[model samples]
Target chain A: MSEQDWRAIRAEAIESLLVERGLLDPADVDRVIETYNDRVGPMNGARMVARAWCDPDFKARLLADGTAAMAEFDFGGAQTEKLVVVENTPDTHNVVVCTLCSCYPWAVLGLPPRWYKDPAYRSRIVREPRRVLAEFGLVLDDDVRVRVWDSSAEVRYLVLPRRPADADGLDEAALAQRVTRDAMIGVAQP
Target chain B: MDGIHDLGGRAGFGPVEREADEPAFHERWEARVFAMIGAAAAAGAYRNADQFRHAIERIRPDAYLCDGYYGRWLAGLETLLREAGIVQADELRARIAALGGDPTRPGGARPAEAPDRVAYPPAGEGNRRSVAAAPVFAEGDRVRTASFGVSGHTRLPAYARGRRGTVTTWHGAWVFPDSNAHGRGEQPQHLYTVVFDGVDLWGAAAEPGTAVSLDLFEPYLTAWTAEVDT
Candidate 1:
């Protein structure tokens, strides 16, 4: 069967299970699912970046205590306990991956992009970070050492992307324009 | 199944695929829970956000129980409502059917909210004690990967441990919660990295031009010099 056909079948099966078990009303599940697809994603991280750009003290706090620092902005949830924030500096670059599974900082960063959870990206990036970054349209100089973080159980990370050069004088929204999800993941720089 | 970080060097995978509009189920639940708690607090159901926050805060530290705690609360609410005849199983099913397809719709029996709050205790709090900064080495300093016995979850991959390399960066002192998280919280050590030549990792058979780096935690290393001690 086609992928769409399979999805339809899966949805039907899930609906049947929900009804039989009476775990949740299907309509409620639908609504919850919609909100998730619409509002969540790297946009969450982009907001964090914009806040960091505008506030130095908060940024310092973010680097020092990532979970607490993020709490000031009201960004925390279940699965956020293992949070560890990594920053990018002039000489060092930070990229995050879960080679085993898609363990991510869901609370602050929202849900991860599909590419992040892909097996292809997970398996190859750690061993060949430079090559993978090149494919993502990022080409770093040999002198700028590349450090790939293998985020596993107990600790998950979010990359504090270096601010973009062209974003000077831009307000939060405008600065947010430059903070792409790729930049946060260290695949690309803003 | 292998733990999530074990995917490196595996074969038969295609190039990465990016999904434009997809969110995991747990994340959706988290957001919905947050909103529900926020709205409830706003409605004065709880004395203050702190009260609600305190309730959750008490349970957040139990890593294993975190996920199931919310699930149980939701289940308990539904059960009470059902037992009191406020809502029937068939009625809930019918409402679901009436809503039709499109799971992304807004408003329904399902809650749409984020958690009340998520907190990570301050560094070196509770069971996590701060480690005194070890002056092992500095960036730009060349060092060799010390040969050490391996057990537990280590940042040092088997392929690169016990290899020689240069110190490219210092990651600062961490709680080393790997031991704690794994129920082996005896000694939480600091972690670091030393970038090895690709030749050192893959041996002489490796391509001469390539280079590799390994982030070695403090416990995995010892002092090294260029000259042989013998």
Candidate 2:
């Protein structure tokens, strides 16, 4: 009688029904989950960010055309058909949210975090971003312009976080390790 | 339609809960539901993300709030499957019963699928379109978002309705979700990145030096005229 039990059973029932009807292949379902859970995720994004940080030429191309630039790394599918990279600078800080729905860059970031889909974030981030970012432990200077990008359409956004203050000596691989998913999402500094 | 899914600027919601080291899915069922949607899309049950989202938007306001993210996704999947005739109401109940679950619960039996026709874009092709028509508004054009009180799905959030903003970037042509969600063909239009000043949206309560940007379709905007100013 528990709700969790119902959800589990209901999910099972639906999958089985689809499998029985030959509309869906169970293997395909497993493949899809594995693709997002394993193959695709924020690590791919970090690698791209790290590449951008190390290679000025690559960064210019990425800032100009994110979808085409990322295609060089063979990263384009599903939610990332149109990828737009927003850079974070000392004068301007950028963050992304899907107010209408949880429209995230799945190919780059795999899946969105729970807080990204939470009603609290959906409702308040655009209105009171300073407070929300502060809650996320990112306090912008009063002069830094805060730009919140609402992924209202198919154009997905990935925040190109500024290189950390102490990251001058790090290589691309080492730099990628320092990039957290939240920092790419513009909630924290890399 | 104005629904609970449009949670842009409403107040009283609590602070966001940031779970440390969160997995993609909290439970196996949630992952299954997530894959179920992807599988359904692959199986030709749903056309695009817009259709899938409209199903989620169709959820009742009360249930919309009660059901978590994947929970709503599960509900939307059930709705889509039932509409596609891939699943039947009786079969769902029987499966629940076979699984030793009570079928009388409110979540078990869902509302009937829409009587409206379904529209599908070419498989592997998303909302993007190649139209020869020029963009209605160019970048830096001062425009106002129209107050489109559409009865079906829309991307224009409640907070930005009738608000004035400057077009910062043009995103080329894309399918308009309002028509696409209701079995209408992909009405591709010019999409732009419009930047609205925080003060323009939230008035004096806005944080200083803050701006909100949205990817708005051409249909959702009009050229701002000084003659119409208050």
Give the whole-model CA lDDT for all candidates, comma-separated: 0.54, 0.87
In model 2, where do residues sit more than 4 Å from their true spots?
A: B108-114
List residue ranges in candidate 1 displaced over 4 A. Answer: A7-11, B1-5, B11-14, B19-230
Instruction: Evaluate residue B14 in candidate 2 and report its C-alpha lDDT on the 0 to 100 scale.
Output: 91
Q: Residues B1-230, candidate 1, lDDT per residue (tens digit)? A: 12223456565565665555444554434434433333333333332222232232222222212223333223323332333344455654555455453333221122212222112222453222456667577887766664653333344455555667777656555545334323233254555556666567656654333455444556666666767533
| Chain A accuracy of model 2 expressed as TM-score | 0.97
- In model 2, what is the error at residue A87, expressed in angstroms? 0.5
Kindly list the per-residue Cα lDDT of model 2 for residues B1-230, writing each as its tens digit: 78888999999889999899887777888878877887788777688778888888888787788778888898899888888877887889899899998777656223424445455655337778878999989888999998766777888998999999999999889988887777777878889999999999999999999999999999999999788756
**Which numbered prediction scores highest in TM-score against the true structure?**
2
Compared to the true structure, candidate 2 yields what TM-score?
0.96
Residue B57, candidate 2: Cα error in Å is 0.3
Alpha carbon RMSD to native, model 1: 11.3
